[model samples]
Target: MFSTRKMWLIFLLYLFPYANTAQDIIFGQNKFTEYQIGNMSLIITVPHGGSKQPSTIPSRDCGCWDMSSSKCFFTHNCPPGTIKDSINCKVSTVKDLYTLETALNLGKEIQKITGGYHPHIIINHLSRSKLDVNREKDEATFGVPEAEQAWDEFMQFINTAKSYSPKGLLIDVHGHAHPENWIELGYLISKQNLDSGAFTAADSSILFLSKESYNIPFETLLRGDRSLGNNIQEQNKKYLCVPSPTHPGPSGGNYFKGGYIVKTHGSKDNGQVDAVQIELPRWIRDSSERPIFCAALAKAISNFYNFHFK
Candidate 1:
């Protein structure tokens, strides 16, 4: 006799109490594939840190994989490394150069900073050459059953985190090898769009948190003095970032400007959760230098969340 909406509410409240209480969930068949699902408002995803190649799943066949080929779907050029693998490849798609290490490093430090409190950390541990979790389902999974299951689990993990907290931040961490060593933050607005002065809240990735949840102006939180960029700057002034509220977009060459994953999972939807895609450079990902960088970045995120997201 209950209405559909009421019934759904009851389902979420009592029938799915485990969904609300479970703090972590791990899904994978092997080391090459895995997803770490956490129960925090802050969601972090590293789509390309995997290195387990079974050769069971066929590597993706995309023109971008060919460096000499003229077919490139992504705005930013493919990064260096992962080229030695003989998978009939030219451009790199095997991995994102220490991205998984960076995510795990950041996650560990954040957990320490939060005093055992955990964040929703979702990682794709399969080699991109085997399965590109960041690409569209068709291109990402290539119709493979196993890879398709991974794709589903990744999105489901994000949705699960969103369900935990009505308002939170989701950051997709990636590695970039541009000539400049600056971090590229993607909020979905393109270089041309930002220059035209026509960019609006609807175009942003974190506009939901900026406008609706926090009741703060989108521009101010994006690049303002109280933004995530500022938090990172506080951690290390030597580090430089772009596309913040102040920078808007990259100055030259092709930039990431965000990707399929960020758009699909970010606050572009009507959800209260906001998201940002941070593209890290090798300088920060270096073994010796990574520890310090991760520590600082983790602290910055903690401070930012306490100030704005919490």
Candidate 2:
């Protein structure tokens, strides 16, 4: 007969491997997987969903970029006497990873529930400190030369989605840090002034979730209102051809300064590539409120896909 301690040890050895595997799936340390079954094509692009900062990049301002320097440095145009460490610069946070993981989980849920209308996701392997997806090639802070390479990756993802054709949509996921805590949604149209009379018109329409639309629920929630839950309705106010919160004057409550990704890829006229940018407030996925916020966002996106795709 076996001793009690020996039997217990044997049981644990078998159990440990299974437990670790389950944790890995939930935590998403493994490589991202894509699923496809139904004809509908929905591509989810997460530009800022990164946590690993490149070892090659420096966190503090060193100097301006020049040909001679072996390691490239970019100027921030900071005011004089600013301490390198004291300067408030955008840095990568674990929050971004959590948000992306939540999005992946939601995507999986959508795939299973929708019977294989799988949503493809593209996430940046490097942190925003290295590159920002919302900026133009010229405006990139660090990887200015790599802009073409990044664009190539984006195009490749688009091409893969296009294989399905006709019934396709692109979702650009992001997070925002705004005082009012809003989520913005809309598309960027071509401004006539920017064109040098070269291209006939802007070739694309990028759909974005704006800060104004998103801020309402977050502001309300911060004020301790939880009655509506995730069933919050869009306030039917208008500003600059987009929906805004019902407040007067040029600076309407719901109007967010839309970013580059929205401006670049959004076009309704060009064979139905709908680009929607979603900006979730920092507090939504902050350490304290992540579980509830994740559920709420998952439900929101699920509802959006079901309604639009069907």
Index of the highest-TM-score prediction: 1
Question: For this target, which candidate reaches the highest lDDT against the unseen true structure?
Answer: 1
Residue 158, model 1: lDDT of 66
lDDT over C-alpha atoms for residue 160 of model 1: 62
- Per-residue CA lDDT of model 1 for 19-79, tens digit only, reads 3224334454443334455535788888888777766777655433444553333212334
Assess the local accuracy of residue 280 in candidate 2 as a C-alpha lDDT between 0 and 100. Answer: 59
Candidate 2 local lDDT, 141-258, one digit each (tens): 4433343345444444444454454545566666656565655443342223112222212333421222222443422321112211122222111101112222111133443434
Full-model lDDT, candidate 1: 0.71
Residue pairs in candidate 1 whose N, alpha carbon or C atoms collide under 3 angstroms: 50-125, 223-245
Clashes of 1: 2
TM-score of each: 0.79, 0.54
Model 2, residue 114: C-alpha shift (Å): 1.3
